[model samples]
Target: MPDLSIQLLPGLKLKNPVIAASGTAGYGDEPNRLCDIADLGAFVCKGTTLKPRAGNPQPRIMETPYGLLNAIGLQNPGVEAVIEKYAPLWAGWTTPIFVNIAAESVDEYAKLAHRLDKVPGIAALEVNISCPNVAAGCLEFGSTPESAAAVTRAVKNATSLPVIVKLTPNTSDIVALAQAVESAGADAVSLINTLRGMAIDIKKRKPVLGNITGGLSGSAVKPVALAMVYRVAGAVKVPVIGCGGITTGEDAIEFLMAGATAVEVGTAALVNPRAPIEIVKSIENYMLEWKLTEMSQLIGAARR
Candidate 1:
């Protein structure tokens, strides 16, 4: 195993640095047939809301050159349904399962967090503040420092479980937002949520995605994600979970060097459900090749 475990949050320890990102991994059960979910450091469930969302219309996804565009609209069965359906299954698993929640208002986020506070299967609550592909205030709460802090404070007050604020890349100053969340009592922070982008069909004179615009994610955004992670990691005292277009062990290493305590695989996992397992193996191999003892030693190694 090479002892790849790392401390992701103050009281949370992960077996490896590779975690499955929210929205990409469906409740840790969908990919079980394709890969071993227990091998992952953790699995972040799909974005849950206070109520069920049908999501955007059809053609919600479009493939770019080296990335993907999506407007899933946080389509989920709400918190109660999530607990009833997957909490029991997660309780039996060895790997930790973090529930990712999204909301239009701070009150909605607080209510959802309070509901999940006592759920035995959940290990943490990832507050998603950067969902740009939807209307009705998805990105409104995350784009500004004030709203971000307020949401963080509300969630922290409602739950004893660790709260990780998921940040968006569309902000003018991500470091400021990260610092604000930390000040507001976030246990940790994760970034960079998908970059806001849209694809247009010139030939058809229509947008490629059903929702005119969508968030872009994949290998193409790795460099931008790394820069944001580097800046945010230095700004916030809490741990940062890097996520964007990480697809390989090398990509994961880049994130670790940029100061991420752990890395989350999103778009890559869609291509290969076993990508996280491979990432874990690759990280171990890299550590062995470099004679490194712990993954923590690699964090912020690129800073120097």
Candidate 2:
């Protein structure tokens, strides 16, 4: 059988390459009830902030043809609450947990990372600088290379934990963003965090999402994600984690071939709670059928 394990960073090693992405996986708790949480390489919890946020108003989510749009506004019970409530129990779980964090300012990002630095059971910090739903400290930092590098440098300096900067597809040049983060000390990068999109209620003649514009994610985004992974992976020396529309083993494999060291499951898990687990099993089956003995053989093959 193939060894699906991948070392995403110097100290952050995962048993497999399939991880439960932030937002959909819910603090590493809900999936444990729905499927074998152990099947996941790691769980990137929802966007944790400095203070609890009420999130956007009603109509925060709207389902599209093969996609789901959301402006959840990085809603969570704040960083301190997450540490006090979930860290202790997560400490016992074998699967690694990464707290996804979103902040309103560069200083806030560093502060959140510093706080999480002391929290046990937190395998790493997934810095979310690309949340389009928020009014501030969101896409602005991620859209520009200088600002993105600044945030990465800030978070990296604040935490002892491995920092994985999440990349936004809304940028003009994703490779530049990836390279900037890498230079600024990101341990790894996860790409394609929902493209900016909107939906209209023809009957009401108004926007369907309360926030006006939301992040678009699901099977519909797989192609765009694949392209970014291919481009950014080629540009950066650090590990790249492909995320966006991955739902099946083949999709995961496609990303690996495109040079992604790992994959994150998001909207797919929302549609089917067991999608992450199923993806893991399916990947193993694919390796068995193909007689592939290691994941390294798949990763970056397309680029070669």
Model 1 agreement with the true structure over 1-304: per-residue lDDT tens digits: 4678888876789989899999997887764677898889998999999998899987899999889999888889888899999999999999999999998889999999999998989999999999997787557999999999999999999999999999999989999999999999998999988998898899999998888999999998999999999998888789999999999999999999999999999999889988889999999999999989987679899986
Q: Residue 32: error of model 1 in Å?
A: 3.3
* Positional deviation of residue 120's Cα in model 1 after best superposition, in angstroms: 1.0
Q: Give one digit per residue, the lDDT tens place, for model 2 in 1-304.
A: 7898998877778989999899986786553577777778988899999999989997899999989999998889998889998999799999999999998899999999999996888999999989889898878899999999999999999989999999999988999999999999999999989999999999999999999999999999999999999999998999999998998889998999999999999999887888888989898998899888888888998989
Runs in model 2 with CA error above 4 Å?
none
**CA error at residue 134 for candidate 2, angstroms:** 0.8
